[model samples]
Target: MKRTTLAIALAVLAWTAWDTGADPIRLGRGIPWLLDFVRRMLPPDLRVLPAALVGALKTVEIALLGTAMAAALALPLGFLSARNVASPAVFHPARVALNFFRSIDTLVYALVFVAAVGLGPFPGVLAVVAYTTTSLAKLYSEAIEGIDRGPVDAITATGATRLQILRYGVLPQVLPLFLSYVLYRLETNIRAATILGFVGAGGIGFYLQTYLRMIDYRAASTVLLVTVVMVMVVDAVSSRLRARLI
Candidate 1:
């Protein structure tokens, strides 16, 4: 059985390699081009620093707002999707909706919103909100489902209302986990928001794309540096928050 499993895995790997065109020889041959690209990007244009900084700030704004909105929307949806909190009929369709949303990539959401709203940070914010809503809802539901039922039953025995039972029982158990998940998703949304600008959704990515298209490697590097710094700062802050909450 082990041998058969290994053979199947090997076959899948081989097929993946071929399908993806993972050519070691091609990569080796591209070394010079890669080096040239890097060399051209050196000594980034400081002139663009101001613009890059603004773009970076926008990216963070989009990500932060997206995470906040998504968390708000996900809270009730999470309850609906939780097996213990909701009946099978309610949870089944809820789970299916979440699965459908989660299946679509964040970039795809950005594209749709961009088309609807016409290019800007608005679309990026919308994209992050839409994608993170489903992702966080699923996580929140799983957290809710995994919580101990002791407190729930105890509350019910006291003839507590549904809201009271959740408040006294479930909230205490899952609040920390849910907050941690929100922080983690905030970190992820920051990264996704940065790239949303590539499609005109707005942020450093748009400037980066513009510079790259214009062959202004130094300007592109400046934008990229700003993006990295912004991401690092957010990650550090988010880590601290999660540590405190968790």
Candidate 2:
């Protein structure tokens, strides 16, 4: 049975690869052109540095504000979605709503908000907020539900109110994991916000797209460099903060 299953898996993989036009020959033919393209992006034009800085900063701002807003909104809603805290009636509906939020792509949200707001970081931030809220809400609910029930039970035995049980018992246990999840999402959102500009939602992506359209590879390379550095720094900092938190 295992051998048959393995054969089926291999056959499916081969079929999928063939169907997708995953041609190794075509890829081999493109190597030199890829090298030439990289050559064209050489030396990273410093002239675009100031503009790149501004765009990168804007991207960071969008991600930061969006993540913060999402975290705030998700906090209370998370309790409503938790199986332990809320009744099955509320839990199912809340889970469905969060699932709805998660089902849509981040870019879709950005595009919709961009159309509504007429383009800018505002739309990008809104997109981030919308995407992140459901994501974090779901994670937060799972964390809440998975927490040690002993603390809750102990608190309840002392005649603690629901609010008191949550505050004194639940929050303390889940706070670290919740904060860690938020930071991880913050890292992801920042990277995503950079490309939000591709749709004019705002960020370094605007400048990157502009350079690409002009075929000004050096300028594009500069933007790429700035983006890479910004992402690396943010990731490092967030990782450290999360390590301490969790």
* Best candidate, lDDT: 2
Model 2 misplacement above 4 A: none
Candidate 1: regions farther than 4 A off: none
lDDT of 1 at 102: 96
Looking at model 1, which ten-residue stretch has the lowest summed lDDT?
A: 197-206
lDDT of 2 by residue, 40-119 (tens): 99989999999999999999999999999999999988999999999999999999999998998778999999899888
Report lDDT (CA) for all predictions.
0.94, 0.95
Clashing pairs in 2: none
| Candidate 1 steric clashes | 0
The alpha-carbon RMSD values of the candidates against the true structure, listed in the order shown, are 1.2, 1.1
- TM values, all candidates: 0.96, 0.97
